[model samples]
Target: MKSFFSNQFINKTSLILLSLFSFSLTSCLDKEGEAPEPTPVAYVTLYHGAPDAPEFDILVDNQRLNSQPFKYNNYSDYLRFSTGSRKFKFTPVNAANSYVDTTLTFKENKLYSVFAVNRLQDMEVLVVSDTVMTPAAGKAGMRIIHLSPDAPAVDVATTGTTGTSITTNLNFKEHTLFKDVATGNQTIQIKRTGTNEVLLTLSDVALTAGKSYSLLLRGFQTPPTGNTNILSGQVVTNY
Candidate 1:
C-alpha cells in the first residue's frame, strides 16, 4: 500500500511539470508570431485649391486617406502618413477615376503640405515642405503661398505700404520660406507686384506669439457669379 501511494505522487508531479512546459512553449510561439510595429511616419496637411473642381477624396497608394471630401479653399489639420515614396491621388467624390495622380516623397519626422491647384482642366498636386522650428520669444513665423491660378504675381504687405513687402512677385504655385513676424492684429494687403494697387485686403488678422502661420492666396480674381470660390486670403495655423 505504501508503494502504491508513492507511485501516485510521482505521477501527479510529472503531469504538473508537463503542463508548465506546454504553457512555456505556447508563450514562445506567440511572441515569435507577433508583428513588429510600424515606424517612420510623417505629418501631412492636404488642401483642395483647385477652383471649379468638385470635392475630392485624397488617396495614398490606392488607399483612401481623407475621411471626407474636401472642396476649394478647404484644408485639413496635420495627419500622420507613412514615410517614403507615396503615390497620391485626388479623386472626385463617389468616383473611381482620379484627376490628379502624383508621387511625392516624405521623410520621417517632417511636415508636408499637399495642394490640388489650377483649374480642373489642368489640375495637379503640388507638395511643399512645412517643417518649421519654434520661433524665438514674442515672435511668430509667417509665409505666403500663391495658389491663385488666374491672378498675376502679387506682393504681400503685412503693414500697409509703410514697410517692406513680406513677399514679392509670388506667382502661381509658388511659396516663400517662413519669415518672423511680431504677433498682433496685422493688416494684410495683396497688391500687384511693384505697384501700389491693392487686390485684396485681410483686415486685422491676429497672429499669436510663439506660433507659425501660412498666408495663402487662393481661388480666382474673377469668380463666377454666385460661386463661393473667390479670390481670397486665408491664414492657416501650423502648430
Candidate 2:
C-alpha cells in the first residue's frame, strides 16, 4: 500500500508538470503572435531638375536602379523603398565624379519627390512630400513647382473662359499648394508676377479627373550654355 501511494504521488506530480509545461508553451506562442509587424515601405519618385547636369544613374543604398542614365527634366515613376535614412547617389555617365550624393530619412505611408537641382558643379536634391488622394468627381488637383534658379516669381492662369489666376508669386525653388480644378485637356500659361509677360504657354495638356499633378518650372532664364532661352516646364502625375 505504501508503494501504491508513492506511485500515485509521483504520477500526480508528473501530470502537474506536464500541464504547466503545456501552458507555458502556449503562453509563449500567444505572445509571439501578438507582436507587431515591421513598418511598411514608402514611395519616392525622382526628377532631374539640373538643366546643365549630365545624364546620370541612381544608386539607392548602393543598389543601382538602372543602366540607362537619367537626363535633364527627366522623371521616374514612384518606386517602393523602406522607411529610414537612405543614401541616394547620382553618378554621371562617363565621368569621374558623382553628380549628387545625399542622404535623407523618409516616413512610412508617404509619397515623395526628389529633385536633382542647380548647376552641375553645385548640384543638390530637393525633397517634396506629395499628396496622392483622389480628387472629387469632375475635378483634378494641380500644383506648381518653381525650380528655375534665375527666374523671378510667377503666376499661373488657365486659358480660355476659365482664364483666372490659380497661383501667384511662386519664387525660385518654391511650390504652390494643390488645388482643385475642372478636368480635361486644358490650356495654361505661366507669367511673371505682377506683369503681363507670358513665359510659357502649355496647350491641350490632359488633366484627368480624380488625379493630382505637379507642374515643374525648371532650367534657367539665362542658361550658362546651350540655348539662351532655357526656361522650361514639365508635368508630373502626383497621384
lDDT (CA) for every model shown? 0.78, 0.75
Q: Which residue pairs collide in model 2, if any? A: none
Q: Candidate 2 — which residues are off by over 4 angstroms?
A: 1-39, 94-96, 227-229
Estimate the overall C-alpha local distance difference test score of candidate 1: 0.78
- Report the CA-based lDDT of candidate 2 relative to the real structure: 0.75
Candidate 1 Cα errors over 4 Å, as ranges: 1-38, 160-164, 224-226
Q: Compute the lDDT of residue 163 as modeled in candidate 1.
A: 43
C-alpha lDDT of residue 127 in model 2 = 90
Model 1, residue 139: C-alpha shift (Å)? 1.7
Residue-by-residue lDDT tens digits, candidate 1, 59-116: 6777665555676777866665666787888988868898988889988889999889
What tens digits encode model 2's per-residue C-alpha lDDT throughout 122-226? 888889888766667888888899888888999997788756567999997788778887778888899999999998888887999888888889888888856
On TM-score, the leading prediction is 1
Worst 10 residues of 2 by lDDT: 1-10
Model 1 TM-score (2 dp): 0.81
